[model samples]
Target: MTTRRRAAPDATRRSEESRRAILAAAFDLVGQVGYARLSIEGIAARAGVGKQTIYRWWPSKGAVLFDAFLMLSEGETGRPALPDTGDLEADLKAVLRSTVAELNDPRYDEPMRALNTEILHDPALAAAYAERLDGPLKEAKKERLRSAQRAGELRADLDLDVAVEMVWGPLLNRWLQRSGPLTPHYADSIVETALNGLRRPTRRRRDQH
Candidate 1:
């Protein structure tokens, strides 16, 4: 009896298709029915797969939406990314500008708000979302700050984690609290405030003279 080799490429292609379908279904359903009402069964039915198929890859509806949240947050490029120009201020400004745009976009804003609300009561879900979605860009920003410190552009004594938060926190506060509109001016001002505090001290004019 001859043994037949299984086709690895076919299996891989099918897996990609199924994953894409599942993500698409979750994204559409969340927008259509809101996050609280979305379910694995509903996603499975919409994706034309068994509920078991979803369970094979993810543990729960929250898990599925964690992946879906990543997709929604990626915008038209289908990737959530930050720029790295040699100038730290310019790079940070570009990213914050992108963020302001994302927050205001109807496609991302509504579903992201829904997801944020859902994660509050579920710590595990919140951690998963943070690890997958929030952590990378944050680490990248911190790394950029550290690079500036190395270049004598910023204070070496500053705690980078706190610095990163200083940049993110105000923007997030304004975004979530709805205290004010998220505009380019606000983003630029926030960046200026954070960066100014981090900049290296200059020699006093009197001392120089």
Candidate 2:
């Protein structure tokens, strides 16, 4: 009988390092050159890997950029959860303000704009984006809403899916369309308005005769 040996731990670490390098290169290059000028050759050259290596892992430049954006969003801690400090309004405002800051940042602005452009045109990439990035983040948001619901902070019957969109959609649209400044004040207004609509309506008292 013959026994097969597992791959060495060093090999796995090297693979992980290479993957991170490729992702980082794609992220930085897109910011520098914009998405239209970004290519696998450039990414590979920047990453210190062969073009074939990138092709082996990703189907297209759009796909590479998508993963790169995902890695950047995840940071060193994998996926992030929405803040839940037991005060839904304050927590949501904090999250939205942070988002506004990122969107306004020069390092993130170009890369995110490029990712949004790709998602608009590529159906396959859009689907993957929804599945891998949007879906998880949306669910995390819904969970926070669910907590608010449990705490009676929101209407028990409130539709969480719509609620999430209501809070986030305006910020995204404003940024993408360049319609307005993405400031902390704008983020706070969004949270306040959305929460007002989502909360249980107050009953009016009868007028005195």
Number of backbone-clashing residue pairs for each candidate, in the order shown: 0, 0
Query: Ten residues in a row with the worst lDDT in model 2?
Result: 200-209
On residues 21-114, what C-alpha lDDT tens digit does candidate 2 reach at each position? 9999999998899888999999999999999978878888888888887776677486657889999999999999999999988888899999
The candidate that wins on TM-score is 2
Report the poorest 10 consecutive residues by lDDT, candidate 1. 72-81
List TM-scores for all candidates, in order. 0.77, 0.87
What's model 2's overall lDDT? 0.88
Give the per-residue Cα lDDT of candidate 2 at 130.
Answer: 92
Whole-model Cα lDDT of every candidate shown, in order:
0.80, 0.88
**1-209 in candidate 1: lDDT tens per residue?**
11234669988789768887998898778778877788899999999999998988887777777787676556446444456566888888888898899899876776777778778889987787778677876777777888888888889999888998999899887887889989998888898988876555576545676
Error of 2 at 66 (Å): 1.5
